[model samples]
Target: KSKFGTDLNEVPREISFCSHTITGNKAHVVPDLSKDSRFVDHPLVVSGPLARFYAGVPLVTADGYGVGAVCVLDTVPREIAPAQLSGLEAIARQIMSHLNSRNLLESERQLSTQLSQSKRQLDDFFDLATDFLGICDINGHFIKISHSFLKVLGYSEREFIYKPFTDLLHPEDVEQTINGFISLESGVQLGLSNRLRAKNGRYVPLSWNLSSNVDGLVYAVARDMTKQYELEKNLIQAKEKAEAAASAKSRFLANMSHEIRTPMNGIIGMTSLLKGSIDDEVNIERLNIIQSSGDTLLELIDDILDFSKLEVDKIEIEKQALSVRETIQDVIGLLGTKASQKDIAVKYIQSKSVPAWILGDVTRFRQILLNLLSNALKFTERGSVEISSDATPTDDGQWTLTFAVKDTGIGISQENIAKLFTAFTQEDASTTRRFGGSGLGLAICKGLCEKMGGRIWVESYLGQGSCFTFTFNALETTASTEGRKKDPFAQIPTDLGSVKPLRILVAEDNRTNQIVISSLLKKVGYTPVLVFNGAEALELLEKECFDVILMDCHMPVLDGFQTSKAILQKFSDNRRPYIIALTASTQKVDIDLCFSSGMDGFLSKPITVNPLFTALDEVYSKIHDQVPSDRPIGIDKNVSLTRKQSKKQD
Candidate 1:
């Protein structure tokens, strides 16, 4: 043996003894390299730690390939023992086997790590998923269930495994669940919606999509529909409650209108009768004040009713031919007296481009103008109030007409202008007190303007003046007014002496209303047969023929609607009198009911002289086939009562 580092032990292949050993699949032993001709002068043999003897065995793999050699060398010449050399070969073979085993073990460890990571990812997905994911067998038994499925059902994994899927369903849903599974068996994908029973005995709605594979396994995903179902149910209930409240409100308004207008009819009617009989100018002025107050009260009631109708979107706009100029002029004329009293000048500026006739609701158009003009006059103490109208043609062959009511009135503040179109709201609390109004006029105008497919707005300074502007769309129409007659009430014929007399009957339940209506009929040159109720009127018709029956609704014994139907049934069309419903109810439904009951015409109360005369004039013209001529007419002497007698009856 020689003392040398491991680097010296590593010899070149040509000089190394082990290199020679690897040439054959066996051991090679040299007793003395100096004696061997092949390696006698080799570097290992001549070097500082010269090896004189050597022994080596080839490291052969199992495949019989000689890769490299294991060897031993010595400085002195020596011979290796045959047993020791055989043992060296055995050790080399063992080393090769160990290396192959280590490589196999390393490959197995890497594969195992990859498999573990994949399984963990799958577990996390199943645990974190919101949807219920599961697998079932052909028999509808749950084979595997995700954590989400177990959590929603409030069940343990053991409780769900191998359990029939239908067992977790609501009793009512079990049949459908089974049917849906059956459908899945036929290769048809199934969508199943049903309720599932939870651990607490509560049913939870679930919507599932399921499909079956060739391996007899059902893959399913489900969503809990509990929250969605609850929201839908709540929305439906809220809608029903809102509708019920609206219906209740409508009924209340109808009843209130009937109750209030019935008495208002009497107050207004009596005031009109009293004004006509008064002789003293001072007394007449007092009557005028009473009449004006009555009219104002009626207007307030109408405003509230109109606002209510608009709030519910119940008011309908009538599209008919109407003169824009005439409507504006009419409003200004009606408010002119008020303007004069307030020391305010009122005027109308009509643009030449403005259409003479357009399709719109005349009554509502007049109402808007009236509200703005009246509001202008009420707020203005001294300055002029002006109404101006202009028109622009739209692409749709319609005119977009803009109307502005400008007044040098107490102007609205910037903040107050926003609240002007809000119902029951004004510039301030003091505004309502100082200027007597319900504050619904502008609000009503806004609603009406929008309903006509237009808008309303205002421009003003706090201390200067206000200009309230509104626009509405209307189509220009060539409607003719050639055959239109003058207002019938403008000059009622005082006498029907030359013409056949109209046998008129008046049915009224209220005593005050009876006196008022009888007096109004007498003033119109007709002596009407006054009856307290519809039944009395019907009884009179049996004995005597009448041309007209002014039937008041809400009468005792039988109502006007019922009486009208009965009268129509009892008499032929030609023999039956023209039935006119005298109703205090101003609701469209009540008015519609009047016509539905076979009444020919409607007269809303408190019945004034003009409307009364107009109704009679229509009747007179229809019966005579011509307008009535001027003739001296007088009330029946028997029916006419003295002022003292009327006061006594009252």
Candidate 2:
């Protein structure tokens, strides 16, 4: 081994496994071999090819703890600079930093893979959830629908995404939900339980809870309420049937009261006049007592029917041209009388912007206002009732004429205010006992206001009085045209020509009703041919071409349906005689049947002369194609129906 390095050209060759040594780590350096005794006698030191000046450092760990290093080599002994050694040290530090970074990166890669796996599991769980999840934009277009929602609706996510949320809702619920959603967007929360149509065209109930995500985005959770809703609906239907029977009984009572008092109105009126004619004060007092009792009975009947109609949802919106100011005046006048009796003053403020003409269901609006004002009057023994109205623009390019009826009366408690609009409810049971009412007045008012596309609310303090405010969206029209078309009850003729009497056919089974209808026809200057049943009426129609046929339903020989069908088949021509239905039934199914059978119109049973005339005018006048002749021009049914006669008087 000592002679191994003796050859000048021979080199000691050994290979190291660590690759870092490949890059200059094997280089050798020898400095001042002449001064070194260790190499003085060595042949390698004297005659070897490159081992003269040796200076080396071991390459170490990545922390710069040296294991090995590069060295310089030369045949002759030479000096190396301190600056060069510092440069080599800097290179070693660079290599160490690189190796350490690589080791740390590999550790992070493994951790990231584990985290990704965990996230995938969570996503899978959400995908498998039973409750449906969905997200929608503010415009109500679906951004995403859960697999469960798609499965329930029989649709794919591809089909539902980007579609309007309202598209899946039942047609009747679409507007309501949309309106609710709009309110929600304005910081209101909407928890909706509504009907949604399935692909098979059946409706299923869905409950939804929604939260706003980012701007203009909403995340919603929904659950299928089909089974629960079905049970609820069945229960509702049962309740509705029971309510309908009760309503019918109430209506029967009202009818009896109306029929008895109708003649009694004449009797009481005549008897009172008779008592006046007589010089006996005792008889007069007795007659006054009798009239008062009848009046009280009539009032009681009205209260019962109002409550029943509200419960059963039988009230329909009736349109008439009414003077807005006049209606308020009438309500105020009635309240003012009560207020005066209590030594309280009543004031009405009319805003200048309030239009003389308006389009609305007059009877309902007036009833609502009247109920509120009367409540105010009843509660306040010594305070004023103020009715006022003003016009303003609604956001939808429409105008709202708001009516507020404020009263300095016994204010309502905050807790009881919410219950005021509930059916058969007052401030409390005690309130109903103290005040004479069925407790359904405010409920009717709420329903009526909503039907008219308005809302009623109240603001009050406990000791101070209350203010009832309502907003109505009224259709606008030109003043001249409004005045000309407003009146529905005016007697002015469409044409000045002497009119021939209409040959009308009256189909009725009841003898008293037949005579009553005949008398009404005679009063209207029309000669009507009376038939005992629908079959007889149909036979009469075939025998002679009548101007109109007033068909009654539920006859012995044939019902209104069969008779209508037979008549329709016979008169297949487009220009058939007007078939007006006279029926006690006002069910949706019944009305739809009449419409489908080509009936021109329907009149409710126990028809008065006014409604009968109105229906006839609506049918016969529509056929005339010009202005309706029976109802005169410039005579608004609305104003007359809602406004006081005194308000219209010059």
Candidate 3:
């Protein structure tokens, strides 16, 4: 009564009804406190503000403790009702609940203020980061951006926050961003990479490291990659240009080979015929010199062509059944002439260990042997150059044929040996001057060995000599070596003079080539119908029945392809003559084109009498269905068929 709450400040606890109500189970009621002896001596009851009636209720807690009392006092005597007492008890319980709730709310407000301060500091740290940092909501809306984003993209936080993250993505990059977010999962690191639109209207490439899944917030560290992207694009363009240049160089070398070989073919072919006819030893020896010089030139051209092909990755190893013994013998025979000029002992020891036939790239096999032998001859002044072969069978039904070419040559130094196999590099500049070469022979051999699933290496001493060893993987074959090996290395059957004459037609544009071919045909006893171009040849074919036609691939008017197509279309299968291609090109593509254009036989020119007669005999025998009595064609005892004859194939 004296203050806001009803607590008697001066009342003695012994006399106050609240004190009694604290002990009582229900509200302690006194109809007249002044008339009752229980309160007559109380100061509050008999003195100032004396109470005549009093009603009190105990404020008991749920655990049964009476913490306080609720009381009503009246100056006049009154009666307490049960209803009013019960209502007072309910109000006391409600007040205790309100106090408890207020205390809890005050504690919570303090914690919330502390948390807000910490978050504000964290956000400031993110804004100060140098990397492009960002926070996005679970729905992919931009929530916060670092100051670095402003530096990188020229955009303020206010301009991007609350906008969909897709808004800044380049049109082409939107799908990638969407995919990255969709794949995002708890603890899974799915990185994001895309182009974002800058304020300057240019697309800026960015790489992002993101961690967002469980926190319902996307946290990302982004890096500017625009410069990196530009560099990569430039590098790709430079690579393309380099490849194009290499291709152009390869084509140039190929064209040069074709041009050179066309004339050299005539020289070699004529020398071969002259060597065959002359019985005088002196004259034959002179012709052999001319033949050797021509072959050396041809080999130089081959090396150039091979280097170009390898530089541009045009050459590939083709696997087929091959004669292992024949490969060694042929290589030895090929270099015998050069070795004989120096009087070096050239020996080939074929190990009885390897199979007679095996599957491998025969051309590459021969090439590797030839290269090593040539290197040996170039280095050695005298003594022996020896080649040997053996094979080890593997559990996988294959064999590793190992060949070693050991020579008594000026040996290579350890320091210089490593430099030998590098393209266009030799041991020293003097080595190049002493031995005229492209420096591609050993490199080409190494590449060939690798292409055949093997490797090449050398063991040598500074003065003792060098030995080159290489291995090739091959499958064992049951094929007979009889099909490959025969008596002569390079021979025309002298009995070719006995072949029955047949009607022939010749088409050539070059005057010198025309004369040479006609003279050779006359020497063989066949009078050939001659013409200058394909159009004239076609006119002759329409007017007469010819058993065979020697068609030149390239001529002035109506090239061979067009003429052949015209004749094949006009004539029936039975009436059409056997079309044989006579051209200078030795490339496989040119031969393939000839066959595709209806050619039945191919003979590369500066054709010797043997291959020329062999080509004629092949067509003649096939047409007549009878083996000719004179001799067989394409027979070489030492030559590996892996390197098919450049001049003839039926």
Which candidate number has the best TM-score?
1
lDDT of 1: 0.78
**Tens-digit lDDT track for model 2 on 1-650?**
11222343323434221223434544234476556664576555556353566555445664545454544455677777878766656665666566667868987898899789986875675589899887788778987677888888887778888988687788778887887777767665678877777788777788988767448787778899988778999999999998788867765755565455445444444443455356688987777677656554544555555555555676556555567777777667645646778887777787888777676676567677777877888888775778788988778766698888787887899998998888777887777788878777777677777767788899988779999988878765433333422222245343311253456888877665677667556644677899888778877766787667787765788977788778767864333466777755444445556656656567655454446666665545545544332332111221111111111100
Per-residue alpha-carbon lDDT of model 1 for 151-200, expressed as tens digits?
87899999888988687777888888888887887888899899878888
Relative to the true structure, how large is the alpha-carbon lDDT of every model? Answer: 0.78, 0.65, 0.76
Two-way TM-score contest, 1 vs 2, winner:
1
Residue 508 CA displacement from its true place in model 1, Å? 3.8
Candidate 1 TM-score over all chains jointly = 0.70
Error of 3 at 133 (Å): 5.7
lDDT of 2 at 363: 59
What are the per-model numbers of colliding residue pairs? Answer: 0, 30, 2
Q: Write down the lDDT that model 3 would get.
A: 0.76
TM-score of each: 0.70, 0.52, 0.69
Clashes of 3: 2
Order by TM-score, highest first: 1, 3, 2
Q: Is 1 or 3 the stronger prediction by lDDT? A: 1
Q: After TM-score superposition, what is the CA distance of residue 334 in candidate 2 from its true location, in Å?
A: 6.8
Worst 10 residues of 1 by lDDT: 641-650
